[model samples]
Target: MDARDRDGPDRDGREADFTWGQARDFANQLIQAHSGKHLTDLEIKVLQGSWQNHTYEAMAEQYTYGAGYLNRDVGNALWKKLSQALGEKVSKTNFREALRRAWWQQGRSVPSVPPSVPPSVRPSVLPMTPPLPAVPLAETPFAEGPVAPQSPFYVVRSQVEDLGLRSLLKPGALVRVKAPSLMGKTSFLYYLLQGVQLQGYATIYLDLGSIDRDILTDLGKLLRWLCARVSRQLKIPNRLEEFWDSDIFGSNDNCTAYFEEYLLQEVPQPVVLGLDNVDRLFPHGAVVEDFFGLLRSWHERARISTLWQQLRLVLMHSTDVYIPLDYNQSPFNTGVPIELVEFSPDQIQALALLHHCSLDRPALAQLMAAIGGHPYLVRRALYELGTGSQTLGQLLATAATETGIYGAHLRRQWLLLQQNPALWQALIQVVQGTEPVSLSPLTLYKLHSMGLIHRHNNRVMPRCTVYRDYFRSMHRADSP
Candidate 1:
């Protein structure tokens, strides 16, 4: 009844007996009351062990069970029971906290204090936040933003202006840019367009990804569409209308010639073409050949009183595209190839600072450990840190979980390993080797590119602890 009465000792000189059974009963009652489930003896014992802050391996050892068996049987079983009791599934990582809260409500002491914040949670200190606004999928005439230097389009502008792409803008001059998805390919094109616009050049942004393969088969329709896009971007009044009204619309070769000879060549300003996902057109070889041929012919034959300074062509693709430029060679091999690498740790720090997060060296190292400076993943993790209410440690832990982008990337690598058993074997061998694993060039390149493994001392190694643990957990069968 009184505060001290329940916990006070009897005349016998011993303190109050806190038997394991009493703990189990208390846990059971809490589960039944709060979670609407009855705990069996084993489940109660498992809960009691977890309440004591016992590791899974220790629990398994104490119960004379295998680690996997304990996890699957006791751990998962407790989760299901708690979910049924709480009306929502509880993750295993949070189970101890939930159980401790239940005990505290009953005036019981927690068995142990949880660890302090994990090491990965660090602050960001970077500048230059991403400037591009997320465009809605349904929007038309996508709203334009500032096309200034130091904008998100800075890289593209730098590329175009610094590289003198404007001078090389000709029908025959094909430009190739290589980067992974969401690495600012579109933004770069917009930057290039700005240069073209400033130089009194007509430009066409042809989104090949949005085009149908069937449309490419009809060379006449493709030419007409290209002309219309050019007209729209250049604000050429009645240009598309005049073309549709002409007899060239019915003839593939004639329409191609019309666009080459009149639309592109006769424009008052020089014309630049921006074709996104140009690789998608490779399937239609004939159409692609004819289109490039027309462009070449226009470059060679077009004659006006004042020759346009440049005919700029910006072609973007994810993978290499081999387009024949000359009779003896392909067009893809001729142009300058720019490969986009992942952001450096310093760049990530810059981004973190832009978001007003603390990206100190430790934090940067931790983040790079988890994501390897992949731009999108680093941006996402930083965004979570910036926007989330959780403590830095909690955010980092969340980032490590499979739900976050870092986890998703790790999962992708795991799945790839599963698909190729040899690769997985090689990975495990490398990780477990006393010395760094010397991998074949092909395997090393693949792993490095995927951001799963890194090179150290000329050997392949896991990128982070999460990946190392993943391999270790799965290596149970093969591990001694």
Candidate 2:
């Protein structure tokens, strides 16, 4: 055959099977060039498994992702991006040949992934061993707020934690942490901020939930609150009057100047500012646009300005931003987005052991069957068990009742639902249905944010058996 014909598929047929590693490197370059975003670890696993012809179910078993998430969420988005990059249709079934053709067209057989920098040559972004203090398992506390930095009960969420840390190390990084309430967003935020602080980066954490309603409604007051908080956290005097001139500069500009002129300059090291419960301001349309727009502008400024590069933002929220935003002016579109998921059975068991509440495999399974590895719920159960307040059986029996350990929590959720009839009805449909029920995006977002439901794609179900049973019983009690 001619040399030209030899470079075609017939040549690939005679060669060894294309290694997933090489395909991974090839696709990473292509996708990054096309989308300006690198493949995530989960996305990499999906690509690797597909290249090996492994089913999504098998991949899920071998990896941390769920089969449905692998198939529906990650896989669908990946294929579309690959199709755009390769200039042809790409799916799990046909990706192998498509990649092979692209491989030959590029005229390179070897992987193009860059070599890792040696420790000596690498930038000193993080310490080799971060000084994370250890808490004796027996002395670990069951605190209500974020887990202490030294707590042994803090179960390291390997994937999400690694991603967040790596993103923060980059100059001018923006890391968005989104999860339902009480799913340990605050706990994870503390863990992350502690890591950066130990690295010698100046860290400031502010929870927007603590901001008053009047301040949230007024742009100037909100900006002033933010400026004052950052200054106080940095041990600097409250100089909002010095930097902020509301009459001359707009609220956004005033906030930016406060950071650019004072906060960033005052801190000798890189500044990592984490804002928690950012969604608290979502209700005020005017504030949401201007505040988030300021954030987006700072992120963009980091790309070229050296002073702005010193600032990195970490935003922690419990739900999606439902309001409209300018496409070019929203920080959400850029930056590393993280969604905290429920814990695995293994993590739950490890935490139980830390609490010194040893239970057999079957007992642990029973607990998960009721609560499904919710971080706070699991911690609370283990805490109660550790305190000798209730037996495993007793806890399970009364879990859905008002007298149970989760009584206050369940009541708060019920109160929230009562305040919104539409949200209440939406959750009712999900709770009563045997299968996942569909709801409007806003309703689903609110329910998920409240930790009342779990969404698998467009459909949602009661987040746990506790919610399902509690809501169902409440409905029955109200029936005539």
lDDT of 2 by residue, 1-480 (tens): 442322223443522334554467557657855775556656777887776667999998997569998899989999999999889998988887787777655534332222365555543232111112233555767747787644556666668887997799789999998876788889889878877775678999999998889999998889888898989999988778787787887888888898888888888898999999997877677788788888989999999998999899999877533323222332356799998988877567556655666665568768988998888898889888877778999999999989998998888788767777767777778889999988887677667767778878878888889999999888888779
Window of ten residues with lowest summed lDDT in model 1:
126-135
Which regions in candidate 1 have their CA more than 4 angstroms from the true location? 1-161, 164-173, 216-220, 237-256, 282-309, 320-331, 389-392, 398-401, 406-480
Backbone steric clashes in candidate 2, count = 0
Could you tell me how far off, in angstroms, the CA of residue 357 lies in candidate 1 after the best superposition?
0.6
TM-scores, all candidates, are 0.52, 0.67
The local distance difference test score of model 2 is 0.76
Model 2, runs deviating above 4 Å: 1-140, 237-239, 320-332, 440-442, 456-458
